[model samples]
Target: MTTRHPNAGLERLHRETGWTLRQLAQEINRLGTERGTPVAYQKPSVHQWLNGQLPKESVRPLIIEAFSRKLLRPVTYGEAGFPEPAEESKNPPATVEGLMELGRQDMDPSRRSVLGAGLFSVALTVPGWQDVVGRMEAIKQNPKLRIGQAEVRAVLAMTERLSDLDDDFGGRYARPMAAAFLVNTVSPYLKAESSSETRNSMLSAAAFLCYLTGWMAVDEGAHGRAQQYYVRALELAGASGDHNTYCHVLRGMSVQAANLGHGAPAVRLANAAAEAAPESTPRMRAFMAGQQAHAYALAGERTNARTALREAERAVNQAESQLGTFGGFSSATLAYSTAEVRYALGDTLGSIQSLQDHFRLRDSTDMQRSKLIFSSLLAERQLQVGHLEEACATWNSVLDEYPAIHSGRIDEQMAKIASLLSSYQRNPIARQTSERSRELCLK
Candidate 1:
């Protein structure tokens, strides 16, 4: 028989944890339960893990959490004896090159492992974010082609176009086109730079497209890929001395973390954005404050959440007097943030009202998918509060709109509604909505 030795990585961590195998297993089970997974492993599972056997994929997160709790720091899958994840590039040239290559790899089906290799690592991305801002310097003049402002504007235009497509059709369709653009057009311009000023503009434009691509990844339900793209965007933004974009990207990271139910890291990233952009415009401050409020709400910090929400509203009011258009956060987005905070704080009626207000204020053409999602949230909250008939009416208003938007998030919301309605499936209203939801999902 071939002998299986103990896994050195597991053994080292186990020793550092200073716990017996049975104790470790008990802790893992407890951690899993806290995470809503109710694991029931004993000493045998820990022994098997120590004996060079990998646990189930779902168990990996639990293991990381258990160790993170014991070690009093974040623990990654690699550090906990799992396979190493693909590392993101740390510098501008490498990041640009990686983004170009990622675009190509994303297009090739045979290279799907490039997209699927690892889970998102907060430890890798978050700690490094603090060192990126204010470190921007002039780019070295690596003149290859005669690039100018027009070329940079072209990229920005394409980014805006793709953003529209994403708003309508979702990221699964836009991601490939965005990737191709980066690989073919943006990559050459990034390599074939111009004067320092032009290069900065070019880099900033590239970073924004990268941020868009990252947002698309999130839309398509690839959180790890999204994190890598956000990291690269941060690097490019820093290289361009665009601290506003840097803070914006950090806010994006917080949104991703919150979506993944990672509250603490979400709060950390949101707070970092607010602190890093002390001189940011009021509109930008409103955006950051909204993010902070969302993260605080997710973490169950009710006082902090309400405080941030008030700050967000005040910043938006302050922004009304500022010069130039506030392109990012509007009153509708603020309402969305308010809804999230209210829902988290157990104000279901308030959440539903806020969402309804947002829907009334938001132009559906601007964000069809988001509108659909908020509508779903409204319906779900209405159902939670025993307003079944109103919930059904809220759901019926968008039955036609559901079939057009190609978003994993939208799909998730529909599935959740279906699941929630399953209990009331015998009711005529619930039955009709359930049937329609099933049809939309199948389409």
Candidate 2:
């Protein structure tokens, strides 16, 4: 008979959690449901896992995530007595090859669900600028294929068009197209022969596209997949020695963390972005500082958050009008960031006021998707403050535009509309809005 010893690492973590076997099993099962791969794990499964019984491959991540959430820290596989995943154990692939694989997976409809199932890890190891700078794998360039400034320009133009699509419509439809482009066109261009300047420009363009794709993924709530794309963006940006794009990608990651309410990681990433910025213009300073303020607020650093917000305001004041600034940090954007910071700090009424200011500053150039999202947020806050009639009016406007936009974040907001207004159904406007929300959800 084989002697099966207990898993000491798992045992230690379990003890630290102070959870009974049943509680641990329940938490894992809950997380599984959240990931859309529901499992009926019970106490027996937990006991077996603790007693040297290896779990099925898919269940391992759920276990780790459950521990991470409960402990409020990253719990690695090693700490949970699991072997490192095969992909992690292997030598990392070349940037181009890796990007192709990721993009291809994203492009395939059947594979997208699996990709979305990837769990967001608080402990994801992000590469430093020094580590990745100029570190792209040597391409075995085909002498027959040469790209120049024109090709780089084409990539940039295509990315701009995609951004427009993402803005008007939403990421759910736009992301697949972006992924296909990355795999089909961008990957080959990366591997093609070009002058050093042309090559670096192409690299920077590709990095921006990757960042946009990741931003779309975040819109669709595929956070883990988004993080993967963001990392690739960072690697490409660093390889091109594009300090601006590198910092921009870091700020995007901070936004992702903040949206998911992972405050510590958000603060860390936002601060990293600000710290790594190179010769930043005033607009860029506002962009970085605005995100820093949001992140610091989320992390409960009131003093730091206030200081960052003031710096962002100062930078915005100093910035001159420029076309095509990265992420467009304008007065409107600042107002939105202020709202976010206020909300994070429990200033609900102040947040609503800031959001109103955001709309007042908005112009025709603002994204339709963003308009709906901010409107929905404004309505939610209005409802929280007992302005039921005002909230209903705002939601009606959101519903009017909702059918045209396909975004996971927007869908989430729509889902909340019914629940939030359920208690106020006695009010006629709330009743109508709730019914309309349900109809949209059904569609």
Candidate 3:
């Protein structure tokens, strides 16, 4: 076995710093709580390192860089991580050259050379993902071209490939890159008159892209900024009457708000998604219900939470109980996770049970990032309940997947873990989980 770092290189991240597993876990759990997530357990510093399980695919990079900051040196993809730029090296490749080249004057020759290679790889593969500069230019071009089916297909295909361009690159690649495509390639078309299909397509693409931008912001620890983007995306998505996207945007908002501690708002937003997206397919309906249930959990309405959760589970079951093309909303776990909102609401024991329920129903490996995120949270919950040895063993086992999970929110949690470690007297685990993380910074 590769004997992955249990969590990429995060397992050893704060090791040299001397923090304990319990302390780490406390800090990690505090992160979700601080963010307004219903979860309230503040895992100890030691648990930060010992917690088992890793982030799922959608959130691997986010988890990795968060802990990365504590290390004396940054870790990218392969060695330590996949690859990093000499300057802003860990940024996604497609946008690396432009993103890093803006201000880099000096860097190691060998590192620079390796970064150059990584950049090339990211660009050709993950071109759909890039930053949001020159956005107005897209509008200036042909607004008539927005979301042409041909273009949507091309960009989406590219996005799928870029999604796999490896963890050395960040998540901004997809969100910003797609946003640029919409603004530059598709937005002008909004000014044109066309079939409902074209308009819907354009709006769908733009809304999702905008959501990605906001999501990237959230991932990078800019919750307020992400909120703005999410709100805008929701409006745009609703404008096009694309309920799927509308629901997804609402879900995103709920995520940010829940983290910010606005349980009522989260619940309201989620409920709106469920109601507005009534015409949604089973998969989409389940997901919408799930988002709502998650909000209910945040609000501490266990009965309501369970009720909505059951509805979501019904949707997921109805979706999976069949065997046909679910048309872009076939993900069963989306709804199942919603049903388990109690976990995020800091119902660790509840979450563990819900997770088990979710695990039973979750049959898709396509969501590696989601699994990691939920799993990491559950492990922290276990640690908070006095499972110190279990926490350490957990971190030792499942943290290797950290490299692939991308989200900046994870960094905030890791910082909290580092803070907790500093309080330890002489615990090596705390030290290890609390070290300074490396970065592909512009300096």
TM-scores of the candidates are: 0.83, 0.95, 0.57
Ranking by TM-score: 2, 1, 3
Off by over 4 Å in 2: 1-3, 18-23, 42-44, 322-324
Pick by lDDT: 1 or 3, better one: 1
Best by lDDT: 2
User: Which lDDT tens digits does candidate 2 get at residues 184-225?
Assistant: 999999988999999999999999999999999989888888
The window of 10 residues in a row where model 2 has the poorest summed lDDT is 1-10
RMSD in angstroms, all models? 4.9, 2.0, 16.9
Candidate 3 lDDT over 286-390, as tens digits, reads 666666677777778778877877776677667654455332333446534653576655666766666556656666534554555555555566666665545
How much lDDT does each candidate structure score? Answer: 0.79, 0.91, 0.49
**Count of residue pairs whose backbone atoms collide, per candidate:** 0, 0, 106
lDDT of 1 at 389: 82
Model 1 C-alpha lDDT per residue in residues 1-443, reported as the tens digit of each score: 11267677778889999999888999877765544357899988788888888888778777876676567468777777786433422343466667877788766545543464435545544524456543544434356577989999999999999999999888776888898898989878887757778878998998899999989888877677888789888988887778777878888899988876667778989998888874667788798899999999988888999999999999888777434643378788889999988888889999988998887877644577777777888988999999988998888876778777878677778877678888897799999998988887877
Q: What RMSD value applies to candidate 3?
A: 16.9
